[model samples]
Target: MSEDASLPLFPLRTVLVPGAALGLRVFEPRYLDMVRECGRRGTGFGISLILDGEESGTPATPAGVGTAAVIEDFDVGADGILALRVRGTRRFHVRRTRVRDNGLIVADVDWCADDPDVDLQPEHALLGVVLRKILERIDGGDQAFPEPHFDNAAWVGWRLAELLPLEQTDRQLLLQEDDPDERLAMLLRLVDIED
Candidate 1:
């Protein structure tokens, strides 16, 4: 195990899977510094979903599961805010996080490989179907969610968990599940409608 791996923390409500792209705006001073530091080091930042806090809002422990994101497309706004697109490269688990004097959070993380069975194609197809259905239902109420592209079973599961409007606990459950087939089944049957 590589023990020296460290990642700049950017906690949010979404999950960023490997090969997936995510856009973000940085206005907070701490995060701005984080971006600058990453640029200086030519490294990426860690993206973990905030369990019970908001960006620029509160300090809370982040979930252990997250992906390491590399800044691909970057721009600066007229008002001095930063914007960039980050592509997920790998999965990691947070050992712990510490807040800096500037309000940015940094964490020690370890790289983790997904279970071998997650690479199977059938799992991806099944998860893709369930995800499409979920999105269709959510879109029935509102019209802005973009159609997702899942390239594999692992990606399908990650993207669905990221895009779904479920609570943090549910998303965490999906992340912790090691079996792609079981996760797909749980997701497919996740409904509490009285009908």
Candidate 2:
């Protein structure tokens, strides 16, 4: 973690993963400051899952695993508010979260890296099949999402694990799994693969 851990936190309803893209509209004063500070320092900001509480109030607990995001785009609203587009660069595990007088949540976190040799489990091949079918069904309607982008079996499982509308706890479980093989296996169960 960088010394910039002192900066504010923005825990969201969703959990983000590394190499993922996220878009956010900044309006509140505290968050605006957080975004500006991150931009000025060229440091990433932590994104945790908001378990409970409104944006203005402090969440009782935020999921420990989160991603550090970089601002891809930002603009000033006519109302003088800021809107930002953020992309996840890497994943981190939260050590602690403290609310500041400025209404900002600061969390101490440590980075996470996937094991180099952990191959995507064999069970995930079935998940690929199911995911393709789901995409076909989804693309038939206007509510379709972008086509799945995957480089390998492991990445495919990860991409689906993030994009699918699984519960927050499920997403956190996937994030905490250090082995790509096990992650892929878990993904299979989520998609309900026959084998």
Candidate 3:
């Protein structure tokens, strides 16, 4: 992990993983300012899972680990709301956080390193097949995935983590894990597949 750096935080009830795409509707003034600044600088903002409180009202307790989200697309909705499509870029560990006057949470975070690439093994073949099937069912299918590395352990693990019907906390745990192999193993245990 790198040395701690400051980032604007957005806490939600969901967990986002690197390489995942998420759509958000922004109305809060603090968040609108965050979006504008990030757009102006071509930078990203941090998204952490809310451990307590609510997404709309006051500042919430956030999970320690978070993903940095880069805006991929933006538009003004018919209702005059800002709608944004953001993709997760990297993972970070929050060292500490402070609430701004407008109720936005800013954090000092250390960037988490990407795990070394590992080839999928025979034991994990079932996971790869299932992931393929799942992707095929998505709206854009393979086109949406774009060059997915089903043979790579980390990529496979992240794809499964994002697609699985797991609870937010469960997904958050997977996102926090640094070891790709261990993450895959844990996913295997959580998913029950029969012949």
lDDT of 1 by residue, 1-195 (tens): 354587878888776766667899998777888898999998999888887778775555678988789999998889777889998777788887888877777888878765454453653465676666766676452343455445456556665666666776676677667776666656666633212
Write model 3 residue lDDT over 9-112, tens digit each, in one string. 99999999989899999999999999988878878899999999999888999999999999999999999999999988899999989999999999999999
Assess each prediction's global lDDT (C-alpha) against the native.
Answer: 0.72, 0.70, 0.90
How good is model 1 by TM-score?
0.73
**Which is the better candidate, 1 or 3, if ranked by lDDT?**
3
Between candidates 2 and 3, the one scoring higher on lDDT is 3
Candidate 2 residues lying further than 4 Å off, grouped into runs, are 1-7, 77-80, 115-117, 131-153
| TM per prediction | 0.73, 0.80, 0.95
- Looking at model 3, residue 128 earns an lDDT score of 92
Best by TM-score: 3
Ten residues in sequence with the least summed lDDT for candidate 3: 186-195
Residue pairs of candidate 3 with colliding backbone atoms:
none
Order of candidate numbers by lDDT, starting with the best: 3, 1, 2
lDDT of 2 by residue, 1-195 (tens): 543344356888777776566778787778877877887888868787777776565544667777778888888878876778787766777777787777788887776765455444455666666667656666442243345443355566666776788987898788778777777878767767554
Residue 37 of model 3 has an lDDT of 88
Error of 3 at 42 (Å): 1.8
* Candidate number with greatest lDDT: 3
